[model samples]
Target: MTIRLIRGAAVAAAMVSGVAACSAPSGGSGGGESAYSVVIGVASEPDTLSPLLGYGKDGNSKIFDGLLARDADLKLRPALAKALPEVGDDGLTYTYTLRDGVEFSDGRPLTASDVVFTYETVLDEKTNNTARSELDAIKAVRADGDDKVAFTLKYPYAPFAGRTVLPIVPEHVAGDQDPNTGSFNTKPIGTGPYVLSAWSRGEKLTFKANPRYWGGAPKVKTVTMAIIEDDDVRATRLRSGDLDGAILPPNLAATYKNDSDESDSGKKTYVAKSYDFRAVTLPTENEVTGDRAIRQALDVAVDRQAMADKILDGAGRPAYGPLPIDDPWFTKDTERGQDLDKAKQILDRAGWKTGVDGVRAKDGQRATFVLRYPSGDKVREDHALAYASDAKKAGIDVKAESATWEVIEPRMKDDAVLAGGGSTGDPDFGLYTLLNSSLAGDGFNNMGRYDNPAVDKALDTGRRNQDEATRRAAYDMVQRELVKDPGYTFLTHIDHVYVLADRWRGLTTQLEPHEHGFASGPGWNIEDWQPKQ
Candidate 1:
């Protein structure tokens, strides 16, 4: 089931329980000084905090602080490491020196040994880490002194710098455990501004400010994330004053703006921001959608503009192909647009004909296939509905369904799914992981079962070239190939939307490619955030 619908169930339950029954935690607000408590809603709970195993954005940003952090303009800035890496003339080895005096919440000192342990553990096949593919090009990692860490790569990967965003775990804590199976996943120790105080699975996670943090104490001492799946319910809770903030769906955002004046609390509005694109994946191995003609027909059938307007409510722009228009590698000459006439022509050429009921039929097959999305993901659900509607015009029978990742993951080889992928800082960090054939079935990405020799070649060339012009050309070729084969139907990139309490101030939003929780959102600069007097 999609996450949106799973959340819808919670919303229904909350409505029955009475929205007014929800109440804020007791006590006087922290008087604009000292400390304060804030509540935010997440669509789902994170799987783990261990960097070796953590793939989702929520945990990645919380328990781990990267060597480099992206600024408001998306430029690289130092976090744990003092500066960008110093590369060898050969371009095959890169070295970084850690900043002195940084300490993990557990009181352990951050050292080059910890960085070595973190990277080595992630690369170990025994770890079964989803991020292994990201480090596949790396040949060796070792610590020279207490502060210097060096990496030798099998190839000169241009994107290696951005991949350094993964958090460094303490060697003292993780050294003894087998990287494959460790209990530390549940309880992680890191140098981030916040420390996990308590976590009750499927309910809530509580975080407290880390006074010993190298970055200094966060102004908001207590941060609570409640697992609420429904969009409507989250919005309702925001309105009822049960939460300090929540991420509202695009369709419901307007409702909040329009109805704010009607409520007794007066009007509550939020600053909206956008990032990341959504797409639908058609596993090339699936019998129903495996045909190139069928995939091309579906792409042509989709009315990208109409979906953006009606479903996204002017919050999104039409996707041209696999890459977003804003991406530097995106080709302006790529072919992506709706054409019903061309769609019909392609299906007819493929020997699929309209049946008595108007659905396409080929070789006793009813052109039918299951289109699945996470039960609680409203954004994906809306996309699935839009695609299904458009497919009908091309005489295709697309049956949309909702299923959990537990169910959909195992069936990915045989079914088409509505899915989205994002990253921490750069386009390569996301694109390479999703399209690289070596990453298929790895975990963090490669969900589409898509493998193309051309894409792999381009990724390799792009990563090794180093020169800006050559690297851009390689990535441009990759995008062009994707536009032709189109393993996934591209959709619009969405802005990050948040609704927060009036008193909360100094929240900074990033155009993060993936949703990585507080660290990537307003909480990134929590130490500098202050309450209104």
Candidate 2:
């Protein structure tokens, strides 16, 4: 199998319970000479602040420092470590030297022991980190003297360097508590540019700049992330001056693009290319979806190009594979275009003939399946409807249903789901997790029980080999194989959009991962923002 990349410039276009006396607008600092603060509206609240559990974007909590961190250009740079880790002994070992005189927000010196504790804690069975698989390549982690840490891998994994970009918590604060039920998960202390000042559960969180931070205190003295679950409400707040900025959908963000009210406000709109892509996971165990012919037919039947233009409002691109088309590792040959005639032909060849009801039937089974999506998410709901409409053209019956995650989880093994997740770090991060058979029952990584031995081998080759040529060849094979018998119908890779006020300057965006708004998008380097004098 071979993969090909398609380079084309195409242009186009959350939840809450009541009962509490809604908390008053938190007015900590009113506008004045000392008011170097901004209120940011976010759609969802953080499940936890623990980095090990994948709390923040790219394993960054704004209060914690990782060994390596990416700059605005998505280039890996040293953060807690003084420099990039040294890979030695055939790429099996990684040695990192910690920065000198770094101190946690609690005034404790950071050492290699803290780094060891962070990794070892993640490896512990009792920790229950959702992203533990990211660190599974590491066989052992140890501290060398005071300022150095080392990692020994079971195999020579090429993406091991990027995986080391996880946060390193202070051993003195989080080492003794249960990771699942620790106070540190809520009130964390670290060496990042800010400190967690206050947390009003289910409402908002506050952060104050760390004056003693090694990277220098953030220019914006304070940040308040207000939890506003409704998309319209978030945009409304941004317009009402309640928020300095907020992550908005393309449709809503466009409203402020040329508004007269924002002309003199120094308001700016940012549209960032995101690595996140959404897909409909077709479970292989189900009789209807189990057939490779049915999967391929459905893949080509759905019009991803239309989804990007109509559903995304010109803020995304049609996704062919897991990697975004613009990504360096993306394969051009893997590009797939919608062809309804071909889809029908494939189904007919597979003995799926249209019955009197206009639905395809093969042997004793009907080409009918239930597709579920989270009820409140408008984008997913629209996508599900569009998919069902397209699948109908190929004589397939798709029932798009709205259900909560609780209901969707139990039925993932049997029903199809509209799912989305990916990152800007490495191809292995998304590929290995989504297709690996070992992760099928993990309840998160591999939602659909898609097991292909050939794909597993290709993914293994891509991860274990350090040579670029070998890795690219392996990934290319993996993409082609998936297109031939896909477990998912790739849809659109979204472009994260945000609107910002003119009061603060220097806010630059990077290619964001799946999680948006926090620690990403225009706020990727918010700590470096300066007041526009």
Candidate 3:
């Protein structure tokens, strides 16, 4: 039986486009030529600076440098470690050796003890990290010597290596401190390429290049991130040449692409590669969506292709289930197609008959549901509107509305939600966080209150399997089950769009998830970036 109980139901509900001019900084040295600084516009201010807390992408990427980082192709590469981990014969034990001479920004040498401290702290119940579930399989983490760290897991997890993407904290500072209740969460110390300089809450965050960075000093001396909630405002700032770069909304990308400003030498635009998926979550306990037939009907009613074309403006690819088609583990044989007739038939069989107003009704109750999305998010708004229109054909009433995250969180238990989340590589990374029943309240990304024994079993098998063939089969079963149940109406996978200054060179884009960061952008290879003469 599926455990449909909504964990932390009250908090479930809580949770951007356009490129404009690259505006010049307000009080900085004129645009003529000094040290290159990039001002980026983020949707929300980071919740905390500590990587252990797992809040915003900006804070996590700055304060913590992971042992491994994903590249543009979604391939894992060593960031702090010397190379990929070596797995033992049983695949439950892995070993990694740190690169020599790596040091924290504080000038202390990085040792295996730091890695052990970071992983153990996160796994310790005291940390309360949302990412704790990601480390559930790890039985032990310890230092082999000064530079080598070894992991012994309770099971062979295929995505265990991917979890290495998390940033490592210093053992000396975090020792004996409860990570869950520590003051260091606000002001963290990291070994990344940049160190936090100033944080003016609700306004901006400033960081300077870490001079002692083991990778080498970044050519870009400073990075400033501003929390710009308004898409138009972000676009305006970008086009005005006040900011070096900003992520563009799909609707505004066309406008920027069409702009024929021959006089401006600073005209620069970049379409970064991404694999983010967007979808609508159907609460399993909700009366209107409790039935599998009703959920499947809603899925069939959605015109995913149309939404990809009109709502996403061709910036997204149609998706039928949780796993993207590009993913190697995706189950291609599964069937997903537009069949309005079939959808209407299913709703009718489920006792949802069309009423006087053409909306479905059962037991004198209208089959109406509220679809909540974050206010001021253009992409979500567009997708919600499209879903509403498509559901109308099946006699289901979908009310699309905007609300602050504070208000939306409490209603997720009883209401449907327009939500989106995905990752770059390893199907386990995306599937386990979103589908595993254990992760509902953990915040690693289970937005929908969905649970199925088959899915759970498949996920468990996939994570524990050491062989590639077994892992692939397990993930394939998960995709098939997810598609059949239709817990979330999978819409499309969107491409990452960015507008950067012409002077900045060596911007490395990645096939990232919804969250954008320096780890996947120009900052990915900041050391290699040089001013274009």
Candidate 4:
């Protein structure tokens, strides 16, 4: 929220690390004039550090930046670009004039060519970025000059300008290598405020301030992120003073409430409102989950408010769909509440009769399926368990299990996975890849293999239409269809909670995306941070 204009950041995934040594006071990272550093604990790490492969696709990439960036209010602002883009009246074209003197970490100038290359490569058929569909509206991208880039879209995509937040990669550095397996995947060059210092894979990632950053060098000399996927482990590290800060669940974060009384020795807490949500995939391939009766019944049966109040410790809200209840795009008609009786009626009419064990059965298939969550994620695990409890009341057996993403990926074909996704900007940013039929089972997009022709068409119309009313109607149809045939049982929308060692003056939180604080929370403007006087 307190973005330093001498501006310039995302989180990539990594293995857990012991960074207790980084708990040093201000001069640990740099000496003399640059005597400021901070370390934080994050849950996941990026598979590849390259933007071409989808790292930092949501902006605040830290090491890289998009042509444009968002303010603390989530409004579009100039980053690599000199100003916002000018769109044609038809809404098919967007053109931006690049900021002069913006140089990559390698001291090379950033131009329109780099912007064009970044988009072109990601849109290439051979590239492995699953987020390509997010850019499906782009018909062509052209460099007008050294500082100007123009994009022509197939339709008047209303959210096209916001999509420019896709981080730009140095064409000279990344364009020469294979985007999928290039050396640059681990080592990248960008025009952001920080440059990668060392990547200890499963341990920690270290970064140094870019002295030649266009906005002027950041005051915070170095930043380190310690990957700690387990909630208790992260909380313990923060408690032991082994970390400067960390994102923690509401229950764990509340334990530190008494410590804030003595401000000098304790940390401050922040509650960042977000669109991030937790939902269960009801895969279309599973006999039990694929049934309309099971899907519909489970959708209405789950006590969304119970999960929000009990599991989240009142830090979040019940998620009716991907959008938060307060989101402008949310359809009020799609809101559902606990109705166990109605759920039983839906199942009974569908012939899913209760058998000898109190579990429903239709034909020869039993009403049961395994619910998977990423191992060590307590928030997701709690959500899965709560969902299972709700399913039990309706005569369905939801066996919840925990596993790493490696084990959960293949099983996603038929098994339900506790998943998280949502974005701060346009509805298309959060919905298209999640519900589009063409993207079913492609990496994480549409993991349930949901196929409703009406939803699919509405998604397209919502994405392509220029009229606001038309887009709203299209999205309303999409949400209504999901309620009619729920593909995923949305549990709750999370408001990310973080406890921080308050040693700096500029610390603040932003309206975050699905990535939470890892890429776009309080540290979204880390470059502007200054050591307390």
Candidate 5:
């Protein structure tokens, strides 16, 4: 599931939300204006605010509240629901009791009907949510009176409860308009602590505290996210006093390290370890990338260590596969260290002969291809360039180019893309759509059009099973299969860095996922953010 709109190179964990700007603390959150107002800079923004379209599907969406929300540890807790859902022993049913007296921002009573509507709409075939596949296990959702909701699953999906973080939408407000083009997409009302004040497309999104929020009014009266796409621009704005905080690349964030002492400056640096990974999509449709030997050679050709150090400024760890090496689910046996010699040998054995120019040629076909990264994203650009350099060492020529998603999307079938997407919860959250043969070439799910049936079977096993041993084994099989035939060259799992005004109290970092900006950032609990009184 590409940034959904950002597939944002942000966190797939926080995909449905984000947009930002930059400024210094100025002894006040918003330049000595309002002590509580804060401005943030994010690299991406949500495709739509509507949950039915997949926005806030992973929670942390400030404008909306889910039945459950994640704690700092990424554990699920009650949000709109009174407590955790009651699961039937069969694992095929989940029952949730709606919190009494809860109300949407519009003052409409929160009812079980609303929860039913939200899930049912997303499951509707007419719905355009790319994340629809994630909820495929659900057989039906019914409102048990006005206070309870029950979901019947087709199978016992292990991470289904975590999926309840999908923000509940107000049926009274959104049910009438077309689900895809509804005005609620822009002007949404929810039970969260904030209300969307305005959305200036491609510029910024402004939010104000919801005074009538069920969780109580937020202390931070106003929060504005300036949608600055370029890393350098975001850093420049943060330095110039246009933003209070911004998610910056490692290089940009390093400049602010000595802005003042650790506890002496008006601003502070925050680092969040994440599952977000930067990888090169090897389109099976391309002549150069389609070759199995070429894919295998390039996999080990790119030095993940060098990328972690030089390109990431040591802010990320080299990724051997989709899951971070440190993650519990990652298979230690699947790790592939860089072997430039082995890469060349593999290519040579496959008849990719080095020509006079040192570039590989097979049957008159040159080992040359274009690699596209989203424009304005410095991290991806640097990764693309570094990958090309590494490929060149193996007698492969990679031409790195920059373009917007509009230009890059259509060309994904033939061109390699520096793609960014990751998840924090279940392996199926990220890997399923990424490698499934069925989703090949479906929007940004499988951009390289990778089709591996063995991997697909493994993915299905991992996604459908409820047993921990069974699921773990399935994922292990998936990672192991990638070791032999990787569809994409995964590079690093980044630790997102942010610079924020030190004036706010109770601000902390959580383990983040691929979708970012707002959902996974320190401001994720903006409702709980208190002024430094």
Candidate 6:
């Protein structure tokens, strides 16, 4: 069956009239500089365009510039800000100086008021901000001057600077609107390289390069992101020359690598080891996964090496823990090898006896739980199937189920979820939200309800302390403790895949976060691109 591609006639009309019709060739077969528009075929679509809600998660950073952005090396770099914030009072306070002459896409000048409003709205109880917990430490945010802003924290939050990567919304437009259901989400106006030209929900969204952009207009005048949820379809579109670039799975991406006929195209597949790992979220409240022995047994029972080799097609590495092995905070002792005999012993000691059907039973409760993964995701599905097969060796009945995020979320507390996580430049980004006791029961944080006083203390040390050595030591302790009773069973760190048309040049990449290619993908610096001469 063929998927329908909705025609973006309105966006095309806008381009032809004036805005993006400047000086490029119009034909597609042989493109001129003006005809150098890119259509990206992606696996998922952004839930909203509102920065306050969830647009930032899936590489929508092109439409908005944060106070700070990460460099190629993932180091904090100034975007809207003139430089990094200055800390005082042992990190309790931070002062920022904004870059002069920055303006939103609507031509509204950016000021300290916009900065203050963005933070206040996030902290506001009335607004449903997904990132509310990330900014909870802020006691107050106020403008010191027209071009400056300052923040006072209730306590010294070590990851405060890193969290500043959040996109800054315009106060003039979003100040009075209900942040939860604002029109700005569908039609956003931000201080970024591109402007939202048109949005055809569930189909495609078109962007026009901002002529007045602070960093200057991007090279590709128009960009269209076609939402193709299926992995096979995204790869198919890339091969058919309908898509300029696409994020593909390892197996699909391998098909395009080193293609002699498609020499005009390119493919990149790399293991961004810094902060990409897939794992299963075993809810502690669930009866089947409540026992620490079950959690530990499942961790070792799953052959991580095989998953990395087979599922990822040798494009990834076995992940022993949340932090990648190369990460400075990673501890080697916590990494355990797959041992089926050991897994069975752990279940036996916990009074879980094998039943007639080969499933384990203990105290009238059977070792069975529905393992859910997002439907249409091939990678997550494969991991879920592999996990279920391995768990059977230890008499555990892990029923693999596929459903949308909407369905899986409500049932998360009662079932195991095959979730994708681990991002942000700091360890606190992953550890704090995933394991924090205070964030339990909330959909965004600690969904598994895996609360441990020892784990909490170690995470706090990393968040409360400012010194690098102290923070490093705290994270090391956290890895060591978690290995004993890991909250999530880490599977493998898969390498992100991308196939791009060779018509464009200057496509560089960095160590990507969990979600590939949006914020830090091959076209991240598309503004600096130059058509092949």
TM-score of each: 0.90, 0.92, 0.91, 0.94, 0.95, 0.91
Candidate 4 residue-wise lDDT at 112: 89
Highest-scoring model, lDDT: 5
Candidate 5 vs candidate 6, lDDT winner: 5
Instruction: Compare candidates 3 and 4 on lDDT and give the better one.
Output: 4
lDDT, candidates in the order shown: 0.70, 0.78, 0.72, 0.82, 0.84, 0.75
> Which candidate, 1 or 4, has the higher TM-score?
4
Ranking by TM-score: 5, 4, 2, 6, 3, 1
For each of the candidates, the C-alpha root-mean-square deviation to the true structure, in angstroms, is: 4.1, 5.1, 4.5, 4.2, 3.1, 5.8
After superposition, the stretches of candidate 3 with alpha carbons farther than 4 Å from their true spots are: 1-35, 55-60, 258-265
| Model 5 worst lDDT run, 10 consecutive residues | 11-20
lDDT of 4 by residue, 475-517 (tens): 8898888899889998898888888776666777898777644
Ten-residue segment with the worst summed lDDT in candidate 3? Answer: 1-10
Per-residue lDDT for 447 in model 1? 66
Summarize candidate 1's per-residue lDDT along 363-400 as a digit string, tens digits.
98788899988776787898899999999999988899
Cα displacement (Å) at residue 379, model 2: 1.6
Q: For residues 1-533, write the lDDT of model 6, one tens digit per residue.
A: 00000100001111112212222223543557534687777665565677677456322378888788777677888988999999999889999999999999889899999989988887787766545767778999999888999999988887788778778889999887888887987888899898888876656778889987998888788888776777787677667666777777889887764554555445434233336677888889899888898998998899999999999998788888777777777886777779999999999999999999999999999999999987778988999999999999999999999886668768988888887666657788777777888878665467678888988998888887789998888888888877788888989876777776666667777776665444456766777877776
Question: Which sections of candidate 6 miss by over 4 Å?
Answer: 1-29, 33-35, 57-60, 259-274
lDDT: worst 10-residue window of model 6? 1-10
lDDT of model number 3 = 0.72
lDDT measured at residue 295 in model 6 versus the true structure, 0 to 100: 95
Candidate 5 stretches with Cα past 4 Å from truth are 1-6, 10-33, 258-265
Task: Name model 2 segments beyond 4 Å from true.
Answer: 1-14, 17-35, 258-266
